[model samples]
Target: MKIQNKKTCIAVLILVTIEQVIKIVINNNFLDKKFPILPGFLYFEPMFNRDYSWFNSMFQLGVSKWIHIVFGAIMIILVYLFYQYLNYQFGTIKIVNIMYAFIFSGAMCSLIDKIFWNGSLDYILVNGFFTFDLKDVYINIFSGLIILSVLLKNKVLNQIDDNIVKDFTKYILRKL
Candidate 1:
């Protein structure tokens, strides 16, 4: 791998490790305990979310664990493919690589949560909004980075074409 790719991989591993370590500490010591951070706005209340997502729990979907695993696996693969596509199109843009690292690390951590922990060990609670963890923060950072990239580098967005879909299809076929 190239130096940039190796760096990105290392970043992903470090982020995933940090997230997993935090979850481990919370699970062992702080599960279900509430520690007020902002009193009414934010707090640390560890929660194990068994459902696949907030949408599933909110709608009472009762999605199976196996399904969650499969879906998570597919998402990880798609994220990787998209990352590859971006790299192929842009030739090692540092910001895109960083975005991929954050997003990929978050997705991997989420998959680990579902597969091993049996759910996400969310410890940060935003009162009246949602409960989340480091993985969620990584994803949110990736989202913000992508938005900023688009706003600052509109030419990159305009330059993208349908080749991404075609290349993705070719890649899948080759793998299959």
Candidate 2:
């Protein structure tokens, strides 16, 4: 494997391990305990989320575990394909790699949660909002980096055009 591939793998592994460790610690030690981080705002309240997401819960989708697992796998594949497209277009960019790593790690952790933990072990709670975990943070970091990259007008992104989109779509369709 290339060095970049190794780095991405290691980064993903480290991220996934961090999330799993936190989940385990929360599950074992603070399952029933709630520690307020900010009064009336934030708290550490561990809960097992069986649903796929807040959207599913809000809409009462009642999606099954297998569906979540399959969707997670599909998302991982799509993200990897998109990352490959970005690399092909921009060459090996460190920031893009980091962004890919974060999103990939989050997707991987979500998959692991679904397959092994039977759901996400969300620990952080926002009053009147929802509970989340480290995986969510990883994904959010990716989102923020994307916004920053756009705001900074990355060269790779600046070169984007209709032809690139068409070509990328062709490439993905071929791969599929």
Candidate 3:
């Protein structure tokens, strides 16, 4: 495998591990408790959603269970295709690879939870908005990045590659 392939694999593994760790912590400690983080703005409200996939809520498709099963399968396949697209479009862009990795791993996490637990685990609540969890956060970030990557052209993506890690590291080192 190439070096980029190895980095991509490591990125996916790290993302999936982080998601699972967060899920385990939420499952253990916040199942029945509601911890308000910002009074009326943000909250830790553990909730399980069983009846539908996340898109169904957004699209309000009211799809049947069989359809949801098919949707899940298709999503897993799309994760593969998305990785291929990323590899072809920006092979050496580590940030793009990492974003796609998170997207795939986050989808896998939610799919596993839906299959085994009869629902996707959602907990964090935003005022006047939906309740979701770390997996959802990963998905949303990936979705936004996908949009930006597609719309903003390669220079923006390259800037992200150049600046994000360096700026983040500088901030962390400054704090340290």
Q: For each candidate, what TM-score against the reference?
A: 0.90, 0.90, 0.73
Worst 10 residues of 3 by lDDT: 82-91
Better of 1 and 3 by TM-score: 1
* lDDT, candidates in the order shown: 0.85, 0.86, 0.72
lDDT by residue for model 1 (31-143), tens: 86888999999999888899967678788899988888899899998888777766766778777788889999989998998899998888888999889999999999999
After superposition, the stretches of candidate 3 with alpha carbons farther than 4 Å from their true spots are: 1-4, 58-62, 85-90, 150-152, 155-176
TM-score of 2: 0.90
Q: In model 3, what are the clashing residue pairs, if there are any? A: none
Maximum-lDDT candidate: 2
- RMSD in angstroms, all models? 2.2, 2.0, 10.9
Error of 3 at 9 (Å): 1.6
Candidate scoring better on lDDT of 1 and 2: 2
Candidate 2 clashes between residue pairs 3 or more apart in a chain or in different chains: none
Tell me the tens digit of each residue's lDDT in model 3 across 23-47: 7887887688888899989998888
